[model samples]
Target: MCVAADWRRLYWWVVLQWVVGVATSGPCAQRCDCSPKLPLVDCSSQQLSAVPEGVPDATQVLNLTYNHLKTLSSRQFFSLRQLRELDLSANMLTVIEVEAFVGLQNLITLRLSRNRLKIIPVGAFSGLPNVQFLDISENEILVLLDDMFGEMPSLQKLEASENDLVFISNRAFSGLPNLLELRLERCNLTTVPSEAFSRLTGLQHLRFCRLGLTALPNNSFRQLQRLQDLHVSRCPWLHTLAVNSLIGLNLTSLTLSHCNLSAVPYAPLHHLVYLRYLDLSYNPITTVLSGLLGDLLRLQELHLVSTGLLHVESGAFRNLAFFRLLNVSDNRLVTLEESAFHAVGSLEVLRLDGNPLACDCRLLWVMRRRLRLRFAGHAPSCVSPVQVQGRMFQDFAESEVARTFTCRQARILTRKPQDVRSDEGHTVLFFCAADGDPAPSIIWLNPKRSVLTASGRIRVLPNGTLEVRYAQVQDSGYYLCIASNAAGNDSISVSLRVRGFPASSRNRSGSFFLDGWSFASGQTAVNGSQPFPFDVKTLVIAVTMGFLSFLSSVALCFIFMFFWSQSKGQIKHTATIQFVPRSSASTTAGRSTVETGRFTMKLI
Candidate 1:
């Protein structure tokens, strides 16, 4: 009896421990939140297939990210009324039925990024009135219908970047009137319509980076009064900006990078008086005008790199007084003007490298005078030739301090009379030359310039001379030649004439060979047209034919002699055998015959 009681007690204790161990192991069912402490429910990275049920009603934060959940039905998440932060990022969610989040009224932070959602049905967030932060980035969202976010009244931050959004319809974002930060960066937004963001009155940050935007409407960003930061970077095709396109925006940091702008427009950037950071790098801007940087009073950092800027107009940058970090590297500038760095009194850490600098007296003066105080030790070195084609720029030492280094324009080789028209088969002779530092190319004006050449008859001589043996009537108009060097172009034209057949017929000879008549003045006419006569060619052909005929006769005579000698003995033997055969046949039949050796018939 004692042993049985002890065993019962031990068994009860073991059973209680097993029950407690399973209760604290994990979530009790699907979509259940079993965070370690503080009513925090984290079901992320569990590879959950279904929306887990049995989540604690007191759950404050629910994390369902990094899962393979396909769809979010309306009733799946209805129990989590107390949930505030919901993370469903990095999932395989393809479709979200309308009103999926209709009951989550207390949700504030909602993340659905990096999913496979192609389209967002209307009223997907209809019940989430208190939602402030919403991220739907990195989805296949190509189009946004109007009033898409109409239900989220309190939504402040919206990140819709890195999707395939080609265009946004007007009033698509109008429902989010209280939104503060709107990010459309890295989306395939090619064109932003003028009224796309018309109703977002409270917007402060608008980011559009790595987008395929080519052109923005004239007043696309004009209405955003409270916009502070406008990020437009890594857009290679945004080559032009209309005046006042960005006028009204109170931007603090503006980035316009890797664009091919060659000149700063006359547009007004002064409207953005609170601007702090401005980046305009990797462009083709070659010149800087006066008062260009004067408008950015509160600017801090300015980057102008690889801008193809070779010239700085006098006192171009003498007005930017408040800039801090100035980066002007990777340009084609040969010299820095005296007052270029005299401006920007608060500037610090200026970088100038990878530029084609002319390190002459003018450059040395800038180094000695203002460089130690402004540029420090980050000045670039010269990249051009000290001695080009055997001439040294340093040899002109006297003019070094005042010499101006200007970029010589490339002289283009062009075909003169560029617009050429003629009847087919018209021959033309073209000439090409140049009138600049480098030679130019001259050529014919076809789809591509092609030279007129004929084998053995047409020849291009070593000295650029073209010669033709006989000009045909088809070869009547123009021929082209292309000559070029590094400079610009000049072209010449040569007119060609080809004799045509007329109504009356004549011969090639001076005297009409066909009619056996000699005309006066040594005139030669063919088909009623007078052409140049060549007697030497005719004489040469006639002499060659006579010599060939004589050789042919001698060959025939030698062939006859060789055959006559081979047949002489055969002829004699054939005659002797003819007589012997007849005599032998008669003797066999008992008839005799005699053969005579000689007979004299000349006596008669």
Candidate 2:
């Protein structure tokens, strides 16, 4: 009894649903599905050779994709006055008779891709004036005649890629004054159709790809004033861009990928001051030369992936104040200099993956700001210096950089000190300077190979200058100056000969006579070798220290007075600025998503 009751309820519910559906929807063709409320008709993949009967007159959107219809006869869709979108893609359409679309006055989009049409009827598209988007790609269109699409005055975006389009007449695009975007890819254009492109004065975006073009001649895009984005990619023979090729346009986004370019066309791009995005990937460019991009001040994103990039010379990105992203991946780069980006303070994303980077001092700024910089994709790792090879820059501690990234050695910068021939009682000085990482320290050694300490007659200043006040005979001999650091050391020698000192009175340990006086084995010898008191030398050192202290105090007092007076007379700021050899990020107009060769980039 319970099962019977449930079956009766279920049958009634089904009957009610069927009645409601039929009443709401208008009469549909036996082969087509129609919804009166939505005003839509779908006959896709029906394998029909002709239009089915009983299609509602109120249908506004018609889909006939994947069909077998070969021809479109006159007035076939004359009654569908309210149709706004028509898709006839993936069909065996061979011919379209004149006036085939006589009543579609309100159509906004028309797709006729993947068709077998070699030539379109003269007046097939005569009445579609309000169409804004048209796709005639992947067809056998041989040549575009003058005024072929002149009737569609309101067309804005047109896609005609993947066609055997051989030649385009001078007036091929004469009627599309309002067209903003056009794509003409995979065509048989041996040269740029500048004459046809000149007619598109209002075009803002253009994509002309897969041609046999070797170069873009001067004034190629001179008439495109409002143009912004341009993609001229996948041309193996395109190796050059004429110096004045982009003279009169302000493009924002540009893609020149998959070309045979040997270098960046920084000369032609000098006119694109408003360019914000650029893609030059898959080229054979090896180096980013210095100041090559000084004019692209507004450029924010750059793509140089898969280029055989080896070097980024210092100042390569100079004047790029608003740069934000740089993709130099899949290259043979060893390292980029920090000084190269002194003008790039606002860059945000830096991609260095798939590169053989040597984590040296040239890239020290990157490791120092590892946390702050956003390294896109894999983190940059060292490919050299055995100890740090294959290790990410972020994996090392801040202190480790100082210990690892070091110079090879310390080199003495000055020439060898000249031999000094001074009379007794005259002062002598020897100068020595060096260059090294962490700065080298200076020390002096006597002829006896003993370190010389600062005292009454001998001293080494902070500037690495050896000063000996009141030089005597014993001071005559070889004086060696050495500069040393953590890496290595360098030394130079000077022979000091005192005129009045007798060599016969000198000892084997380099203790020579100075006016009948010498210090041998910590003993003072006078004439016949007798011990002497150290009171005289000690008194002279005391007097010299007191006098030097007095001068220093006076100098400080004068300096304070001068500064105080200057403050009262004129005000000065206490703020200071330092220019360290460092580099970082910048800003841009906005963010977007663009697909490139199967790789999608989310610009920030």
Candidate 3:
């Protein structure tokens, strides 16, 4: 044994150089692509200007996307401590240094989307305490200060939508108490800071579309108490919403579409009692009043499409029980009041075509109620009466439209003769045609009964015609024409008579003749030239007492139709005569034949 084979050949050459330095230290790394059966490290779009040191310390996905990586300094992935996904998204990232995600404590997804990140400094996400998805969306970041996402206490989704984000400071997002989802869409947020979402108390989906928010103030979303889908839309200068904004929201789905909202502030949506799905579509909201969506009792689906709505009042969808789906399509609705959907008793999808719906009988309760309306078969037509204009509401016939549709009560179809005389300063029209069913309300009261108010030469027109213009003499007497609806009121008076010259005949001056002929002696005279004598025996006794009062009203209407046709034919021949009372009659007849012997004559 020559010295025991030289110490066993130097212990097999030091175990072959320590197994060749652990097999060449594995993660290859020249221009990255380390895979090793999937610990992945692609180094995407590699035009890399940094962040590429020998990766693979068991790298757990680290795609430096479209890389031109500019400054992410401090410990930039200090040898990928088993990085759990870190895609410096489309990077040209301008500064991130602070702790620059210190040694990403198991970073669970951190993208930094399309970056030129304007500002994020404060601890630059200190050590990404287990970052749970953060995007930094299309960034130029702009302003977010305070805790600037306070070092991601397990962030749960944030997008910073197309950011140039105007200002966020306060507690920036108070260390993200597990943020659920926040997008800040197209940001330049004009104002929302007061408690900037009070620390997102476990936020649950919030979007901020094209904002320049004019007002959403009061406790601005009261710390999103478990917010559930709140998408603030296009915000054209937002338009006030304060009353405790969304009080302690536990919302389900609230959109606030196109937001130039004219009105929808029912005490800040009455606290969204677990709101279900409400859009407030394209808002310029004209009218939807009655208790304004009641209290949204767990409302189901209500969009109010193209909200320039004209009227929806009647109990405005009451307490929307479990309201199904109602869009109120393209608004300016013409007529709906037959209890305007009475209270949406679980309405099953009703879009109401594109409105202008005035299909008579007030839509006959939607064609005699069976409401399962979906409107895909395109119905809601009738813009109005020209014999059912475009006729469609399910081709109507609810009892032939409730027997030829007649809501009659306000009947004043202008039959003329209510005495009108206008000549003072001329101009007089009157005319009021009414006949009703849901279309009445004419109102023109005047002769001191009040209500006639259309100023300067008086007007009223729109078909109910009144137009007085220059007629003075205090516009003479009685002028009603009321005409109400819901089947009731029906006025008609008229009698105007504004002739002329009577302010005590212009202070008794004389010579008045524009057809109201008067040569002097006056108390007011027209045509009759009164002031005394012209009596041909009282004009033959007033034309024989008006021709004996028109033949005494035609002999009292022919003696009341001949005694009402002889008392209606003696009550119909005494109910078809039927009397056979005879037994004792036979006996009495034979006895009376003589009264003890008299000649009895029987006649048939």
Candidate 4:
């Protein structure tokens, strides 16, 4: 009877343990929330140290965001084989054991962003065969090793932005054959090797913004044949682009703004014929040379804002037949040549504000052509000629332009004296004033007819004043002031005479003059003598006087010929003759006698 009672008590204890196990494993655990209707689990922000265990096996979506989960063991999701989406974002996950996602064969999307993961071990995602989207952004990932995602062949999009990724192996993305978009913004990568994207032929979009890269090799994207959009912005030190950097890709839109480039790399850009949108803003490119963008036949929009551009060559947009939008604002352009926009006849939107534009006749073509340009309410202002400054280009009148913006010929407005006197070792200035349509260039020719350049003691002021500091006896000769422009050229002459010493005593240097009329002693002067110089100013004056005298003589000759011809035509003719007749007496004696007297005529 005692043995029977012991067997009975042991049997009852075993039955009670089975009942507790069955109750705890039904659809939910102590901290996790489960829904049997939709087969979903929500264990987020639970402050749990590990994944709750009693989640339903039929759960297709798992939400574990904002949790204190520290590790992902290999059997963490072993029961959720039908899990299609998993969210572990904003967690303290530091380690993911191998085969951590082995049973989730139907998983399509995984979010591990804002985690403490520094490395992804091989085969970490080996079981998720159909995973299409993976986001590991804002993590501490240091490097991307080869075959890191080799198990997920169906992965279409991957975002690993804002990480500490400094190196990516050549075959890091080798198995991702269907990836369409990859974003690696704000990474610590210094360079993207030539074979970094070797086999991503189906990739349609790629971005590498704010990376620590300095250059891009020619073959960086040689294997991305179907790439449509590429963004490489905010890379402050990225300046170099090889000749064939974008040769093989069929890109439709490319952005390289704020990369600190000094010039537009036209050689590599010429290969992208199918490009439609291009942005090269916030660079230091100075000039847009002709044919630089002529090969992009189908190009539609171009952005060159704040690029420090000063000039645009005439044929810069020759081949952009379908171009619709052009932005060249915030540049240093003063004027666009007459043919600068000749090629973009189909342009619809044009942004030209924030520039120091000279609104003269050169820009009248835009108004006359009646281009349907959409300025977006911000018009460019003129910055030249004082009268037209601060005026808009569209406000210029066509009828008044010829009278107001006429190309005037350069002429001398102020002339220096025929002869100037200066003491030895003194300063002398010769003045010349000129006026023209386009500002004329002022040049000074010395007595030797050689062009004078600014030197130690010789300087040309902005207003065409030649200042000779410490003038010596050898500087005593005719200096010419020549002002020239596209319209014409004018010149004036001034003879400089150093008074105080003869030619032989010039080198003695006893007492010299410091000012034009004062004398000083014991002062050192430039000790040299110029050769016997040719006075071009004197020759010019002589030729001009001769020409005027010849003109005067020709006028006199013409006046004399005119008067002689008038005198010949104005001769008056007068006939003074008296006619005497003696026929009356013959009438009375008709039969007797008839006499006629001879008449004498005097002409005066």
- TM for every model, in the order presented, reads 0.56, 0.65, 0.34, 0.62
Deviating ranges (above 4 Å) for candidate 2: 1-25, 409-604
Residues 1-604, model 1: lDDT tens digits? 2223533654565466455652333354565556443456678888997677777765656788898989998756787787777899999999898889866878778999999998897878788998888899999998888889988878888899888887787878867878888888888777765587768888888777887767655777878888888877778888888777786688888878876566765364656668888888887787878776666678777778878877776666555667667677878776565556545446566666666655543454444334344554554555544532232233334444344333333343434453333322233333343344222333332112345333234445444445544444544555555554322334455555565434264344322233444467666332222243334456579899999999999999999987987887743322222223334333436766555343323211
Name the lDDT of candidate 3. Answer: 0.73
Best of the two (2, 4) by lDDT:
2
In the range 117-203, model 2's lDDT, one tens digit per residue, is 888756778899888888999999988878888888888889999989889888888899889899999999888889999999999
**lDDT, each prediction:** 0.65, 0.80, 0.73, 0.78
Over 4 Å off in model 4, which ranges? 1-42, 57-60, 367-371, 376-604
Q: Which 10 consecutive positions of candidate 4 have the poorest summed lDDT?
A: 525-534
What lDDT is reached at residue 595 by model 2?
Answer: 31
Worst 10 residues of 1 by lDDT: 571-580
Q: TM-score winner among the candidates?
A: 2
Q: Relative to the unseen true structure, what is the C-alpha lDDT of residue 287 in candidate 3, on a scale of 0 to 100? A: 85
Candidate 3's error at 137, in angstroms?
7.2
Q: Specify the highest-lDDT model's number.
A: 2
Ranking by lDDT: 2, 4, 3, 1
Q: Which regions of candidate 1 fall more than 4 Å away from where they truly are?
A: 1-33, 268-271, 341-344, 358-604
Better of 2 and 3 by TM-score: 2
Task: List model 4 lDDT by residue over 252-361, tens digit each.
Answer: 99999999889988888887889999999998899999877888888898899999999898777876778888889999987665465546568777788898876555
| Model 2 alpha-carbon miss at residue 216, Å | 0.8
